[model samples]
Target: MSLVKNLLVSISCTTYNHEDYVTDAIESFLMQKTNFDFEILIHDDASTDGTSSIIKEFEEKYPDIIKPIYQTENQHLKGIKASGINVKRAKGKYLAVCEGDDYWTDPYKLQKQVDYMESHPECSLCVHAGYVVSASNKEIQRYSRPNKINKIYTAEEIIEFGGGLFLTNSMLYRTELDRNRPGFFEKAPVGDYPLAINLALQGTVYYMDELMSAYRVGDSGSWTVSSFSTIDNKIKHFDQISIMLNRINQYTNLQYQHVITRTKKRIQFYLLVEQEKFKEALKEEFKFIYSEFGYKDRARMFLQGYFPGILMSLITIKRKLNL
Candidate 1:
């Protein structure tokens, strides 16, 4: 409930056990060059590592700019999201997100997004592309872009693409859009995707083809790693996503029924593929979904489904030859 007068943007960051990377994230927020005032609202979910200490160092150095919530107990284990806490406490016209493991690269990133949002009041959210880096911060590649140029995405497109369409740290959206989020958002397993969909529902969502941040992948304690570490967890996550989409469909009053159904089918198709149910995946209904996969992936599926020995032999040879 703390309000900052004339604060243009509030950077909401959540962290847990990110000792090695928290400094980079804090430094990135401090490095932003902007004409308007911005505040950093960081929530430490009782990190077991030295992440809290690092955040404290920055908080001490920049008391006026950094407002952090240090948790004594891990709220995540109790089913409370730290991001939710940060969002409720945020006191900015616009909210930008950068997780503890991610960092912004462009000093003018906030300025650029703020300028666009200010001029274009209809825009609910603005996101840019960024570099995808390894756990050690080595640049792996640029985040995949759905469009070759800057474009505005529709709600249907956002629903169809789901969560992975945009980089999380590159997102900046109006704070009001998040204040009245639908009830389903509280239960959504993934935050960024549902938030984006909600924003798209409100107004225009613009994408700028600018590499303005670095999104770290393969972080040990990251959501992706924890959610996909086991087959059971993977299935559980898929089920959660399915439920979220169903709720979204209801929340939209079935206006986006077709899009939500298509997304659910896509997820179901992946689950079937993961379970190696080739017969089910080859059924007429699911067969069309194969077109979404690359030719190499289709080939691999065929090989795995029919010629397991051959596929294993090829994999063994590839690994032996370091291909």
Candidate 2:
């Protein structure tokens, strides 16, 4: 691991039962064209699908660059977050993320991000656009930032977007800002959003309008897949989001109160719909209108509840229109 000296970046790649996809992920990291040294902190959360074997092979081949963490048991199943574990172990100036199911497309991704961060020292995070392709690669779409490239964003700009502006896999952050996260992280659901918000609070975040990564959709081994595979799992997901947002509110001290409340109402609507509780979902529809939701979402719930025939007809027309 002699090449680990003066590491400029640390790539955190967390995997579980990703035997079919881990190699592509590792190869992407190895192909990066960066001037400075970097290390890969890949964590295998005790996969039963022989994903660990592939990781071991790569580690053997690149002993100096690929550092693998093999968990004895399924840490995610046991409520242990692999991202948190990897972050604690990563000792680099900047942090890059590439989950096992996702891979980088551009070899110059790291070099470009590093160059930006080096020149613009005030920014805490740099994010780029990515292509979202189906598992079979038949369907592809681009996920991009709302603003133009090289646009700097403050904490308020991030929160006001409601849903985040960029995808999880297309990000690089200052390790120092993320290293000391608040205690609320224990209740956090997902790593990307909360971590982005945390960094934005400390400093500005930049969005580069470049497509450097490809995110795979419908990954059966993803945490959302493993956890939210059933109706009960849907309940847990929404509840966890509530806990996470509450913790975030506590840390931010109600600065984003209205947005949090609106989010809660939105989740409440989805929770009811997932459980097929139409009556309850209708109730939440009214709750959202008074709070923050626009006319489109409001009209959707009304038609689905009051005029099923019209809603069906409208949905059919939209499908035919393909707009």
TM-score of 1: 0.87
lDDT of 2: 0.73
In the range 186-237, model 2's lDDT, one tens digit per residue, is 5577677677778888887888878888877666756655666676776776
Predicted candidate 1 versus true structure: per-residue lDDT over 54-125, tens digit per residue: 998888888888999999999988888787888898889999999998889999999999999999999999
lDDT of each: 0.79, 0.73
- Where's the lowest-lDDT run of ten residues in candidate 1? 300-309
TM-score of 2: 0.80
Task: Go through the candidates in order and give the clash count of each.
Answer: 0, 0
